[model samples]
Structures are given as C-alpha cells and as structure tokens.
Target chain A: MNTITHYSDEIINAFVDGELAAAERRELLAAAAESDRLRQRICEAVQLKELVRGAYPARSPEGLVKGRSGRRGARMRHAAAAAVAVLAVSVALLLPRPEPGQRLADGALSPVLPLSTGEEAGETTRVVFHVSSADPAAARELLDQVELVLREYAAGNRPLKVEVIANNEGLRLLQQGRSPVAERIRRLDQRYQNLLFAACGNTLERLRRETGEQIRILPQAVIVQSGVSFVARRQQEGWAYIKV
Target chain B: MKTMRPYTPFLLLLSLLLAAPLAFAGSDDGPKHKIVIQVSSDDARTQKIALNNAVNLQKALGQDNVAIEIVAYGPGLSLLTSKSRQGKRVESLAMQDITFSACGNTMKKVARKTGKEPQLLEGVRVVQAGVLRIMELQEQGYAYVRP
Candidate 1:
C-alpha cells in the first residue's frame, strides 16, 4: 500500500503515455510485477489512455501519402511526417488541460500590495525570503535576520520591500498557535510597514486533505494560491530572492 | 485527383523548404545535454561528491555545451548555507554557471525547530520544492545524478 501510494497519477500517466525513459519504464515495470496494487494502477492508466483516444479519435493521424514522387521528395515528406508526429505527441502528452477550479489567475498568489510599496519610498530594494523548513527555531531566526537586514537599511534611510513566502513544511511557521515564533512574527509585522508574509495555499489544502486538519495561519499571513509561482513572479519583477 | 497532379511538385517543394530548416535546426547547435544532481544528505563527504560530480561533468562536457543544476533539500541544504564550511566552494562553482537551488520546504522545517532560517550562500536560488525542480529538469530531458 505504501509503494502504491508513492505512485502519483502524474507518474502513472507519464508511464502510460510512453513518456518515461527506458530505465524508468523498466523500473516501473519491475515494481508493477511485484505489487498487485501497482499492477492495477498501471492497468487503469492504460484503460484511461484508451478511453481518451477513443473519445478524441480525430486526434489520431491519418495516412498522408497520395502518390509516389521522387526519392528526394519522398525523403522530404518522411521528414515532415516525422516532425508532425513529434509535435502531435508532445502536444498530446505535455499539454494537459486544466481542470475547473484548478486554474489560478495571474498574480492571484501575490500579496494585494507589493511589499516594496509603502509611504517612505526613495528607491525600494525588494527582497523575497523563502522558507520551506518546519523548524520553529529556524523560522524565528530567519525573521530575525530579515529584521536585521531591514534595520540596517532603515539606518541608512533606505526603503525596503520584504516578503516572507512559506510553502510545504515551511507553512508550519505560519500556522496559528502551533508556530513557535507566532508572537515574534506578530510583533515584527506591527513594526515593519513594508514587510509581508505569505503562506502557500496549495500546501494548506494538501495538509487538510491528507491529515483532515484545518490549519489556521497567523492573522498576519496572506494565503497565496501557489508559493512557487509567487516567488517566480517576484523574481521576474527584479526582486532579490533569498531562501532562509 | 487528375487536377491535383500539377500541384504535387509545388507541394513537394514547399514541404522540402519547410522541413529542411526544421531538420537542419537540430544539427546547428547539436544536442544540448543537461543534468540535475540531487543532494539530500547533510554529510560533508556527500556534499563534496556532489560538487566533484558537477566539476567533472563540466570538464567532460564543455561548460557552454552542458547545463548543470544542483538541487539541495532537507539536511543536504547545509551545503548551500552561508554558515556551512562548503559555502565558499558552492559560490565558486556557481561562478562557473552551475545553478544551485535550495528547497524552501526544508528551510522552513529547519527554521521551526531551530527558531532561525539558515542563511543560504549568495547566488543560490530558493525553489518551493527541491524534488519537484529535479522532476522538472528530468522532464526537460536532463539526466538525473545522485552523487
């Protein structure tokens, strides 16, 4: 059961779609041979592929040849056909349509206001601190460091935009009551006008689904749809990214 | 069908013109080789081996010809921390264009127990999930190496 649970639907789909490399294919096949549950999963995946193909029959290619020409023309046609085949396969396997309610709007995961935008502004040095560890002490230390850096900038009369983005195990630090540094975080939030904390919604949802625990985050933390996308967006906006 | 006969030669020429570039495009740059190295242990020796692997790979395949990314997660992330003994070494390799990514998940976990976030070395990017990053690189045809 443990082994079966480890095989995600994505992996199974990749295997069924022939996207796995030879080594991975061999490994998965070996595993499937040993576990009835895994074998069932593989069987289900194959059936789903057949069902999809059946539903989208037009997606399957038809013969393109009409009449024979010269050797060079034949070679060119073959190359073109092969290219088309590759394109079709990639489009089919790589581009999975998003399910309803699964798609997020652009910047939906970002804080309502950019962390760098505040009253005292000359030139804003935007920085995003990423936290993914579950250790409460480490989370507090990270916040401490963030404050140290911010205070240094403040001494120089510089405006700073700071965001602490937490995902996965790091989300624990944002949990209310459970977080060891909750008091420190609240105090820091009150003191820093330009600092923000974001918790990953994806992780929260996963925790709820897996453990049936309704985790409540600190009042200071904003929920972002996905932490990675938020970080990527910040990076693209030219913010300095730091992992703490 | 008889009327379409005259258009066959033109269609063949058009297909050849289109396909020729597509075929030659692949040869112009040759194959791009990529590798993702995973570091999930805190052992200094293991960290050294990962670094050695990167250095050796870069030497074997000219740096510009190969893309290499080292992903550190869990306790192995110590290798990229500013306080780590190997911090200087990590920075040196990063200068050679070897990407170093630290897992944010691990950082938070460590922060929870320690009440502090481990300061990462300069130029090391923090990703939401280290394993996911490796999976992405692998999906993009990068070879996975766990040295």
Candidate 2:
C-alpha cells in the first residue's frame, strides 16, 4: 500500500538522516518509487543530510546511535548510526585502493587518505574553495574573501566550514616560506576551526621531481592525495564548491 | 548562438535502457538533483572549464536528472555576454535546460565602465545579484560547484 501521503518532509528528512525504522524505510522507499515528488523530496533531504554531516566530517554517528532500543529518539539515533556505518563501509569498499606510486598527495599519511575530523556540532555552512591560479594577487584576494566569509558567518552566529583545496600554481599559497600570505594563513589558522587548508600531494611530488627543490607546505595545511580529487569529493559530499 | 534541434526521446530511452541499472531514469523524468555553479573569473580558460564542468555533470547525471544553473558574477559575467568566445556553447547548453545566469549588478558595472550594458547571449537570465543568487540557491538545497 502507498503510504506516501503519510510521510511529511520532517519524516523524509529523518529518513535521509537514517533516523527511520526498517519498516518505515521500506514504506518510504515504496512510496518514493511511485511518486516523483517523493523521490525529489528524498534527494533534497539527502543533500541536507550531507551538509549536516559536513559539520562532523569523518566522525562516526555513534553519538546519535546509542538509544534506539527504547525511546523513539534513541531508535532514530541508532538507525542514523547504522545508516552512516553502512555508508562508510560501502564507501570504503567501493573506492579503489590506489598503489603507493599512485599516491599524489601525502607520502606521510596512510595509503588511503584519512579525512581529518571536524569538531563543530551544529548546522554548518559548507564551502570548498578550489585554488589553482598562482597569482599572488589572486592568492591575496582569496584569503581576503576567506576571511570575509568566516567573519560574515561569525557575525551572523552561523557555523561555517571552509575547505581551501590547492594544487598546481595555487599550491604556493600553502608552501612554507614561499607563501605570499604565510602570516595571514598562520593567523587565520589560529583564529578558526572553520578553515581547512588541503594541499595537493600530486603537485608537491611533481614540483619536487621537476625542480628538485624541497617543497614544504605550511604547518597549517594538510596534504590530500590530489587537490582536484579532494574538491571533487567535497562537491559530491554536498559542500558548496567555489573556485578562487 | 544556436537553436535547439528536436530530440528523439525514444532513441534516448532505448540507449539508456541498454545502460540500465538506472544510473538515471530512461526517460525525461525531471531533475532529482539541483546544482548551482559559480564562475567569477574572466579568464577564458577558467570560463571554458566552467561550461565543460556543467556539460560533464549533465552527461554523468543524465540530462534530465540534474538541474543546473551556472551563475556568473564580477569578471565571470563575461562568459554570458555576446563577446564571449564560448557564446555558442552557452546558447547550446541553454537549450539543454541548463540555466545561464548573469549578475545584474555586474551588468551595471560594465555599463558604467563602457557606457553601455554588456549584451547577453540568448536565453541567459539576469539575476539582481549573482552572489546573493548563489546563496539563495544553496539555501534552496542546490549543490554548488565551481570548476
């Protein structure tokens, strides 16, 4: 039976959040199958869930999982945790493991890039800034915009998370001693849990090989496998992507 | 600028049917996902990549399964203008239901600079403020990307 009419947006969002019971999930899926409107709503809910998850990157949903055996909230939390677990497992399994030579980001980290955890716990405004231009003026402008955006969020009392993914010529902005805005970056790093600086490993390796110079990244930046892939993953995960 | 050639839906469905595990529905079932892309650069290379990103996304998601709006502001507004090197591509994508938005604020700035408003390519919508439009789209649950 189509119980589509019974499912409200709240219920749908809860479902997307993995807060639904097995029977409820089945019911919702069945309903969604028949109604394009329901399917669309589910997709939107999925987007919101991913956005919220951006506030808690790589952090397991166990905090939301403990109590489903009794209270409804508990059950919802349990379901959410289970859903996230399944997703994580599937993601890990589905993603191909690259060879050692294939790694373009960090030689120091695990072969599989470990996504850093974000500590924020609230509705998050997520943006992934992609920087590929090497222009110092552009770098300066990018930092200016980054600072302006963070301040705007603070001014509005909204929690924001920004990931600056750099590669190619833009990687210079994160290079130690070579960066034009090193001091500003250091200061920004001190000021916000809001900003994440992701340096591309591939670019570093290439630069090292081509130039034979040690390319040290600023202390505040983390080297991801590839800046481009990091941005792609962020976009796929529902982060608003901005090219700077 | 180019006009749309009539599409044969049956052939498309037949092709999709061959690729089925339903990565996308076999017919024009409307978009399940909405994306808002920003292009704020005047660099021809960057502008070209933005359009390419939009087109690639459509190809991957199935043209009818993802709604895309490419919003250009500041120097990026040049991509939607008559003078754009990619003007023909913009018009072609416009026919694919991918929206092209030019910032009205940028239009005024161009007018003040050149003593005339920048003319837009066909089917491009002008929004009052590009940044604000992007914020609005994000609020409305559209995934935002800039390539």
Candidate 3:
C-alpha cells in the first residue's frame, strides 16, 4: 500500500528541483494522477523547492488543483478518474525485481536537511492527523483526540499547527451536508488557522460523481490533494503523524 | 478492522520530538519509485484492488521507472494460486516484471491442511514469509500500500 500511496520525500523534492529525468518525471506525474496522496506530495515538493529558490507565489501547476469548485469538478471528474484507472490497468511490460533495500529515488540518497525551525515563525508543533475511515465512531474519536491535543498544546503555551486531512470514507467528517459532526468542526475551525480541516480533492470528486451532489464542504475546511500525501508531507517536515 | 488502540492517548503515547524533521531519501539513479502492495484478503474485490493498484502503478510510473511487487499471505494466498480467478492477470503481470510473492509459511499451512503443496501461477516467486517480504521492502524504502 505504501507504493500506491507513499512516495519518499526525496523523489518529490528532486522532481520539484528539476533534478529528475523526463522519464522519471512523467512517471511521477502519472502516478500522482490516480493517487490523492502522491499529488499532495508533489504539491509539497513544489512548495518546498520554490521556497528554497525564493520563487514562492508562482502559480501552481494545472490538473494538480482540480475540483476547486463544485460545478467545475463534476462529471468530468469521473471520466478523468476512469481514464486514469483504465490507463493504470492497460500499461504492462517486463523488468527485473529491484533488490530489496535498494531505493529508487535519487542516486545520491543524501538526506536533505530541513531548514532550522528555531527561526521558524513560532513555538509551534505541527501535527497532521490522517482520517480515512467513514465510521462515525472513528470520526468522533479523531475529534476527541484532536481536542485533547489542542488542550495539551494550549497548556504548554506552544502554538500547534494541526491539519486534519479527511479522505476516502473519512471525508464525511468535513462534508457540509454529510458530516455528522459539523457543529464541532465549525467550533474548532473558528478557533483559529492553527487547526486546519482539509478535504481531499480526489475524495470530493468521487463523492460528487457517486452522489451527483455538489457536496459542499464546511466553510473552514481547506481542499487538499489527498490525506495520505498530506500526512506524508507533514511527516517529512518532521510533523507528528496520527492515524485516526 | 477492529480497534488496535481504541482509547490510547495517541499524543501521550507518542510525545514526538519536534527537534529535527526527517532527512530526505532521494537517490539520483535507477528507478525513481519502488512500491510494495499487500494483498492479505480472500475477498475478490480486495484482491482486484490490489492488482489494479500494482498495474496502475506500472502504467503511471512506466515499467522501467518503478519496481512493483505484490505479496500475498493467509487468505490472500489464493491470489497466487494457479486456479485463482486472477491467474491470467497475475501471469501476465509477472511477465511484465511485476513480482508476485506467495508466502511460504502459508503454503506450508495449506499443504498441511490439504496434504499437497498448492501450485502457484507461472512467474510467481515464493518468499520465506509474506509479511517479512513487506517489512523488508518497507525497510528498503519501498512504499508499502495495503489495499
């Protein structure tokens, strides 16, 4: 599942750095097409590379940001997903099994050091929560844990950067019309930008297609590429990862 | 599917050190991506999802750009069986350079129960243990996905 979901941060950073070959770049793009997480990793990679290059604020690439609007993301979304699925099944060829422990990312495999956080804006501890289950109990459990974490950080007088990324079945937690816990989410969202609620774009597209509903998200919920990628990025940046 | 830690105070249990973020694992050569998929269910739907994930990965990343592996165990051992519904697809995928690993432990169990070793499809590889294959792949930086 990691292969289908996770891409090492190195590959993404390298791609964003334009240090990868065309063949590898296309593969990454194609893989990111069907994966919500891979796309998010790509987004993080782009942001980090740009930040390093002092080129932030440039427009994000297209397709990577689909499903921003309700009407805009409908119908066509399914076709695109179907096409990608079909493409996924159709491609085939022969290759040798890679030796175990041999990474496929960069040849150097050097660890890219993170920028010093002491100089970061605040005494903040970033925590990214991954919510993928559709079960109501699971959603409630996540919120409960989140509240506790929020309180703990509050006690420490340390700012916390928290992102609750909802994807797959767990997306129900953030849906304006579908979430069973809308009130709680609103209360938390209103707390401040520190606690973010992100709706997975791919999950939204799927929901829109399956139900033929605009399926509005909570007002404060931000749209992200995918939950797995969001969590992966946060983990890469040394943020805490919580699977709820 | 049951709770692993229903009431475990996740934060208290894992008071993470926010000192330094993890170091990157980027290499400049070979296939740029490696993924290992786990198929541990006997359900037809789940088995197909796992296969689709593998083939889609192959298509998206191209055969040469990514190394793919599918490891089966427990009930999922059905996936690598010669008589399995996915036999044709598995054989075709194996020829495409995708590695399909059957659990030797499961094979021994099945053989003990049925009094004969189950035949795996052509090109499939048998590992000493299925879960261990996944663990090793993960340790090697192969992305792990359980579908």
**Candidate 1 lDDT over residue span A146-200, tens digit each:** 7765676678787676789999999999898788888988898878766777778
Off by over 4 Å in 1: A1-122, B1-46, B53-147
Restricted to chain B, the TM-score per model reads 0.87, 0.79, 0.80
lDDT string, candidate 3, A153-199, tens digits: 67777656667888998888888777889999888866643576777
| lDDT (tens digit, per residue) of candidate 1 on B7-90 | 799999999999999987876763378888988768899899999999999999998888899999877889999877788889
**Highest lDDT: which candidate?**
2
**TM-score of the first chain in candidate 1 relative to the native first chain:** 0.51
Q: By DockQ, highest first, what's the ranking?
A: 2, 1, 3
Candidate 1 vs candidate 3: which has greater DockQ? 1
Q: Tell me how far the alpha carbon of residue A59 in candidate 3 is from the true structure, in angstroms, after superposition.
A: 24
TM-score of 2: 0.50
On the 0 to 100 scale, the lDDT of residue A118 in model 2 is: 24
lDDT of 2 at B75: 79
Report the C-alpha displacement of residue A95, candidate 2, in angstroms. Answer: 44
Report lDDT per candidate.
Answer: 0.68, 0.70, 0.65
**Interface RMSD for each of the candidates:** 11.0, 2.7, 9.4
